[model samples]
Target: MRSRAIFLAGALVMVALLGGVTANSVAAATKTTVTWKLSSMTAGQNEWLSDLASTNSPGVKTWSKTGSCRFLPEGFKGFLSMGTGKSCTLTLKIAKSGKYPAKTATHTIIRAPSPATTTTVTWKISSLTAGQVKNLSDLAKTNSPGMKTWSKTGSCVLSPKSDPPKLTMGSTGSCTLTLEIAKTSKYSAKTSSKTMILALYGVGDTGPAGGTIFWVDMTRPEGSQYFEAACAGWSDRTCGFDLNEGSRDRLATWGCAGTPITGADGTAIGTGEQNTIDILNGCEDSALAKFADRLVLGGQSDWFVPSKDELSQVWVRREAISGMPGSDENYLSSSELSANLHIGMNVNCYSGCYIHIQKENNGYFRPIRSF
Candidate 1:
């Protein structure tokens, strides 16, 4: 009741100030309400909305603004925006005229800051093969959570026909994937491209050992690891899930009890196999849990624990493997950083996780052999 009296008194005052003539205008003024939206935005993002300033009054509507943001004309119909660039408060006014006079309401908008960054979108692989199936998330990487798109020139089709689409190489020929991530409020936009060839034995193909090839050291270099994208994937023997389990048993202490082992501490891409061998020879606790060194998968028994970098290679290209770990999964590397701490790789929505973790903490492990 008190609020109604205040509104009626305010409307009468507005009528008196405007020297109104019509009775209907007075009623409309008392019944109308206005709303303001305070939004934070990034400069140059050019994001706009339809209700930055709005009202619920009949008859012809009028709106106005005061700020650095683009107003009125840039806003279509009832739409409004603070516009773009350096921040400032935006004062807005809206009015509704019924019969003889117009009733007005006013409000202010809040401004915010935009952090600057150099955004980049990169392809995980440089080439592909025809009739090969691949996940889009595995093939491209972005620094922002913005839109991703592609424009190509060849026989290629994105499959499952859904958002964050998967890729299936169509028939034959060469095409390009334009890796792009558009700007969001926090980060800038970026784009890059990589050519994918529809040939045979590309990075994501199956190696002679029937494992997904992950690293093809470019020039073959007389003794290259493999000519593809990943190694064989194993899901049965998880690394850090249990203390009375495989990795914690004989594979305990990252090879030696209290000191870093010599050959087992390598953290590079081509060093995992050696690191595994060294661990097997040096640390032999009497337990019958299958470690990476004792694995005999894919018709070969040379499988070893991947080093830090090798584990990363396997992780980044995990989508190409048949049964790789999903999001929020972890893999132990053969690289030991300190007492009971080893390097490992983890998969998540956002990544940067090549750090030293507890050897018997969270996540799993998979062994990969360089054929």
Candidate 2:
């Protein structure tokens, strides 16, 4: 009976030992370990860590592993992932070196030992540089909370915006004005600008003056008659004036002569001025001379139709006075070529020739006044 009791006690002890061993084996099957091998990363560089693991016993079924990184410093980010083979990798990259001394981050690894059980391991990462810190500070300063702002550089200036500006052309006979743009602290300078031109003119010149200079002579002697004497049958015809008559004779025989007369300037002499005045005075408001008589230019009231010589001078300088040459229009002169014909000049004449149209023929009229 004592031997039987000893066998039973031994069997009970064996059973307890086996139970303890079975408990230890189950604990070992579910146990997992995770570890990180990196402590810091450099700025502007990539860091890779492949030493992370989620190890478990072969008895553990349906296990999964995952890794993640968070709370990284400014300008820094990290990635972590677990592969199908139960291995984990952490990758870190720095986009910019911002203004900061050092940055801190947390890396976490999760291991699922079973469908309903999980274990997590966490650690800290610290890495940053002075230059990166400075950069980050600058970015923050430019983009503050209250109102964000930025800076840029460039310049622009306009002198006359509403009206045309005037410039005096000195003795050099030319004038110029400029429009410019400049560079500011934030902008670069520009090389292109606008330019304006100012035409030149003489002091006593009249009419549309620019590009070239011209003058009209007002050297008529005092007390000269504005018209010739009354004559019949020559209303539309010349009063017998010749082209070669001298200025003195043309002036003395104003009522009877059709002469080519000239002034001291070589083109202002002729009897046409007197003839036009006489015709207009006789006919009152019906004559072309009335058009000249009514003209008031530059505050002068004594304008007259030009003589043949005067018209010639105007034609020669037409470009300077009007910015363009005279058209093919015929202009009347006060001189008479014959008893039935009145003298006229063609502005577009190539050889500066004279013409005789009927006294009543229509022509363009340009009045002149002495300055």
Candidate 3:
């Protein structure tokens, strides 16, 4: 009986120890019961706690605070981090009324270097020049390791023809360029647009007739003022001279019976098309004028023989034109000097070709048109 009582007393002591441990276990719970952590964030980044997922641990009391940082949108759980240049600590204290002991979760926001940005996105030059190359890299100053893109939305042909373009302006108008830079680890993302005005066309540019642009009259009346000397093989019979005049077997003449034409004496830049029309109406068989009238090129059919002064302009800029027909110096002008002596001009080549088109080239013709 004495031995059994001793064993019974030891068992009672063990039970008391076990009961105390169970009580302590209920008072001190772990994160396994209620899950949460400090929101993920970057130190130098300007961001809101709204960018993060919220924690609504069921039936658990939550309290949060920060050191040398900010919580935004709301003070209890929302935070905006203007915390730059150093590590920011967000302390979250979570507890339950009768379950877990009060504990704090310290989250250190990670720090990284700031991004590089373009100082200015404006073009260095006042405007774009036709037939000249503009360096796009000069438009901005940045240490970003990524590329800068330049683009425009229109039918104008870029010189290299890429999405973001480098262009030789096709005509005279407005040219707007857009700069786009994608986000990168070392650089911030950015997009900016600027419009530039280019109101003049230079000689020696590609014209509407798929021919060389030799003259641009921005000062003339709007529409159809630029002149393109047609490309080689101007997509027509040379000079329209083979077909006899009207019904008679008469080759092209300044007028019927080589008679002096009455109103075919225009000699200016804007008068070539009209001169060709006048000659055609007067003689009804003028080939030079017919060639200019009937030719179709670059999807345009407005070709014409240049007048005397117009032909001079062509002579001065002949080198800028392509597919110049025959080396002869008897090229006819729509302007006539008299009955049998029609005004004419051609390239005079001595040391090389130079503009002395006070001369002529007859059979193979030089033609021009407006667009």
Candidate 4:
């Protein structure tokens, strides 16, 4: 009986010691649970937290938890890390500052005042010049009365075009740009606007025709209003010659039958009348020699008629064509005019060479070029 009692007491002591150890282990785990979340984030915001049940684990600057991520304010340069199965509330208060090197200043080139539903966007300088690039942030401030200035938080870029920069966008969308001057002081503080939509995109791979892109040097005017002539004045007769009083076809008494007329007309005529009677005898008369002369658009003097292949490119982008103003017709496609021509010229796309007609007796001339 004495031996049995001693054995029972030994067993009871062992059981008590084991129970105490288990309780202490559970208490240690409970003490490690994290409850705080992150807040007040500016540039490089950082925080550190202990892992559940880790007695002496230090905090990290940035770490991932399953599918979530953590960021630090710019000034706070430390981190808080957690391990698998660990849970922590991350409350963040982000500050608006333009300190991030990755972020960019933005300025937008919009077509109109309330560009809410505008798709065909055109942009021009009201206080600037064509081909001038400005930072998107600057542009936005210039254009809008109330909007937050862009922070150095995202990519912003500028793209200028010699012509009015055009873009297609959702009715309500925004774009960013970086702008610079390319013309004289006379061009400064000048205003320009787009007839279509526009937005700035960061540097990337793209097609030549993907965007309204141009390069400008503020020293002198690189683009001009030369391209924009009164639609009536753009006619062959108005551009290159005056008609003799009698016959339209018979070249006037000028000594050179085919020389383009440089002298101004003595009489004044309405723009509408000029377009109706313009004889295709000047630059348009010769498809090969003078087809590209006397271009007037976007203030450019070097404008020319697009070559056949170039015109074909325009044909493909017909969606972009804002046809001659005050006319019901679009520019003639090779297919559209072939059937209507009183005099048909050669049009062979395969051989890569063909003839085009510009006769005074038949059709009118509509000059065009790419932007």
> Which candidate's lDDT is highest?
1
Whole-model lDDT values for every prediction: 0.60, 0.38, 0.58, 0.29
TM-score of each: 0.41, 0.30, 0.41, 0.25
How far out, in Å, is residue 230 in model 3?
A: 0.5
Clashing pairs in 3: 71-79, 72-78, 72-79, 72-80, 329-360, 329-361, 330-360, 330-361, 331-360, 331-361
The true-versus-predicted C-alpha distance at residue 120 of model 4, in Å, is: 21
| Candidate 3 C-alpha lDDT tens digits along 1-371 | 99999999999999999999987785453332423343444554556443432333333534454554566555455455646546666555555433334555556665555545544344454344454555455444445555667677542344434534455553556666677777676567777775654544456777766776677665467665577777654544322222223111112334444466777778778788887888788777566677668777677787888777767777666656644433544456777666666676545543223232221223345678876
Please state the error at residue 237 of candidate 1 in Å.
10
- Greater lDDT among 1 and 4 belongs to 1
What is candidate 4's lDDT per residue for 1-371, written digit by digit as tens? 99999999999999999999998886664442223333222222234532211222132223233212232333453454322222333432222223211211111111112213212212343223323345433333232232222222113233334243332222223333323323332222223232212222211211122221122112223332111211223433332222323111111111122343222111211111122122223323333223334444344333333333433333333223322222222222121112112112222233222343333223223443222
Instruction: State the lDDT at 299 in candidate 2.
Output: 42
RMSD of candidate 3 to true structure, Å: 20.0
Cα distance off (Å), candidate 2, residue 117: 99
Give the per-residue Cα lDDT of candidate 2 at 108: 40
Model 4 segments beyond 4 Å from truth? 1-19, 26-34, 38-236, 239-303, 306-327, 332-371
Ranked candidates (lDDT, high to low) = 1, 3, 2, 4
Error of 1 at 189 (Å): 28
Write the residue-wise lDDT of candidate 2 on 1-371 in tens digits.
99999999999999999999998886665444334454433222233333332222222222222433332233333333332232233432222222212222234433322231121111111111111111212212111122212221222122232233222223322222222234343333332222221222231233331112233112234333121121111122222223344111111112222322223112244444565566554444334566556644334455566677766665666543342224576666666566446667766768666887665566665555432
